[model samples]
Target: MGIPVDVISLYRKACEHDTALSGYYNRNVRVESDDGPVMVRVPSAGAETMDLAIWPEAALLDAIGPHVPSAPRLMHANIDPPFQIQEFVEGALLDDAHPAGAALPDAVLDDIAAFFSQLLAVPVGELPAAPSDWPKDGDTASFAELLLRLVRSIRDRGDQSTARLYRDLGVPEDPCGLLARRVTGLSTRPFRLLHADIHRKNVILGADRTVFLDWELALCGDPVYDLADHLHKMSYLPAEDERITAAWAQVAPPECRAGWEEDLRFYRAYERMKSAVVDTVRWARLIALAAEPQERRAYAVELADKLDAARPCWIPASDTVLTPDDIERAVDRWSATGGTG
Candidate 1:
């Protein structure tokens, strides 16, 4: 299907103000309205179908608006195509404010903890139910099962390169089983709504406050999983990781922190496994768009770098690691197979 006429009209009007800021999954344009500036998000076709959530970000924002103050307020949304208009949050992205791979400032850490604490306070019973396939609330086994299902779905969808990579890295075919075996003596905690993806790029640092963006990957799961996802995605330095972890512990409810230190390792591993599969699919899509050899090489390098960093987290003792050349070969094979398994 072609772009909707209404969407085109909206884009044309938005373009009058300035150029649209392009992101990997969404195109954002700032438009001035009678009220003020509004951010219009046009999600990529791929992104709209990536998750099975009942409501998109806009709807989620509306449901949680009464409780969460650190997120953008939704003004409008179209459910069919997944387009949204929200209050334009004025601030620098955390990525722009801090250097890459640097530790976040103490003030920023405090802001994050505060936001998360407030978010956790919102009663889960008030929110919409997640799709049946999603992990069940407070069920660590279900969380592990969900991760395995995602991996299996990717492999079954003909992404053999990702499957082989997982195999070579010694990631067990049965992720749920592996998780169960590893956590035989571990305890479970209460689950809550989580902003499953909270990398630096998703955080906006305003003069006096911090705002979080991109709620597309939100989930209802163990709260520690949210912290683990954030820490891994931020790639913070060791000392900074410790400091941030300590800061979160200070503000988080006692139940949220119960056995967190012990459970964090498994969560991090799950995150790494999930990220690897997601990135493989993303890189394949990117490679298909690269018309030049240099562009393809650059994409391969990026994929290799990501895989290398995540290797230890997912499979710490594995002897197999993909070099850039190995990644290039894999990409070539994927491309040869027409990006299928």
Candidate 2:
């Protein structure tokens, strides 16, 4: 592990990066110059998404900085032991309890809709086909397998919360034989670049408007996956209105928020199920690595509470409408898993 970085050090690093400050997600001192204020957020690294560019943030800054509109300017970067310093992103994180998903006034929902619509309008294929360390098989079956492994990892560590959620949500035990063949065969097309994890937390509020953060999980494929991600990370309140939601209703030749309502439904179920499974693993890791035993205990308690809250409804259920294949997969997973991913 590297030396612990704090607020002061982050301030210096911000100046070094030639920005007002670095935003949250900086482990080694995140700060910048406001033209000099620094924003720093420190979170644990997940080994699973290591290649997602969790460490050595420079590589990510380099890859995505130019691609996204309204993103923080990347003045400088380096990738020694995995550290990243970027211009601080301004804005408040939308509250999970806030019903407005994107945290905007009702009047602003149309603008928000236009924002995402315009975002989708940002042409793809123009950028070079950048190399990525994306999984060998980026299919649903492979993804299910990854989730199952994560479940097993936590289970082995004596944290069955993750496995239990998978079980309750009807996730299969493992993506072996039949399940693999079936899910893989379902989709007949290719994939595209999707910001896999774009929750309210990953979004930053700006004077101009909302902007995204945490692009490491960015991958090429499935516009539905991106839409599903929104549902998965839905905050308690929505910053959306009819117009904003309706903005996604269009069916263009190259639909940005691609897929029919049914496709969106399928992807939502898939992504939400995966989120529950992963949250458990993440909780387990957080607890296991906590320096203080009391902290670990409290975290476990929080995990249990969260699971209980999900008993009647998982986060995405209200927003998720289902179709046949989605139902079939659910039933199939429930039958096989016996209560674990």
Candidate 3:
């Protein structure tokens, strides 16, 4: 797709110097400007519209500037057009270096642990308010409540294809209450800033240090949640996963380590359910709107694979794990419903 005219105009006005479009996705663009490379992120064109909060990454980068040497710096932003210009940090994505399902090197693991330790130290008072849907600081009930809200929202907004997937999977009617029960009796840890999404793709391995990217999902929550997120998303080997957990326990604050083993299980299950919902919704959209039959089929298969991977994490074993054939049938049914159901 062509880059938006307003983004092109912003690049010209900001640098006046020659600019090269380095990357483009949806409406967000990365341009190499005279000053330096910058990322122009457009909020309206993305899929996360349900989130009502203004992008908090720039404000967060400002607050933690002194402490986090590797975080990208915010250069400028405009709310009128909903564009953010941020310094583009240069480094290989951790996934690019260590592919998914591979063991991460010890050095990388240590750097990641240290990164979380420092992030938790940033005073929440200096940061902007988190997204309204996010749980308030240390409010364990809010954690489960937020997940339940999201599940309900997805069901309400999703079409028949998504509903069918949910039914086939036997997703609980009251996931929030279920999650709340699972997490009850856990010792409450002091809340701190958490990069709620810390997979390999968001970790940039720099020459001297590791820089975290895409703070858009950042929030204030239990620090252990961050560790659980990283462990689940990184696809670490079983042995490596255990070692990394041990390393994090050694470095994480004492309060953060309380009920670490049990809490990780709860967090992992939550993450899996959350991922399943998101993927199912995306697949439904693709089935309805994607013009290419090949593309729709590809995404359906991918989503099915993701659902399968998350099967083990479901609180109660799901009734049915979706297969590629089942997804294709759902897509056909969606088409038959004229994309309305």
Best-matching candidate per TM-score: 1
Whole-model Cα lDDT of every candidate shown, in order: 0.71, 0.46, 0.67
For residues 1-341, write the lDDT of model 3, one tens digit per residue: 55556556765564443443322122345666667667765543435533212345667777878877757777775555455787676678788889987778889888877887788778877777766666666775566455557665765565565566566544544434456566556667777877767777777787777888777767677777788778878888898888778878887778777777887888777677667766665576676676888887788788787777666655565657777778767766666766534
Which wins on TM-score, candidate 2 or candidate 3? 3
Across residues 121-235, which tens digit of lDDT does each residue of candidate 1 receive? 8788877777766656667666655655666565445456655654543444543444546654445777787887788888889876788888877777778878888888888
Is candidate 1 or 3 superior in TM-score?
1
- Compose the digit string of candidate 2's lDDT tens values, residues 69-130: 64455554433333444566556654432344335565344434444454354444543354
lDDT of 1 at 141: 60
RMSD of each: 4.5, 9.7, 5.2
- Name the regions of candidate 1 deviating beyond 4 angstroms: 1-19, 22-25, 48-54, 80-82, 132-136, 159-177, 183-186, 284-302, 308-318
The TM-score values for the models, in the order shown, are 0.81, 0.58, 0.80
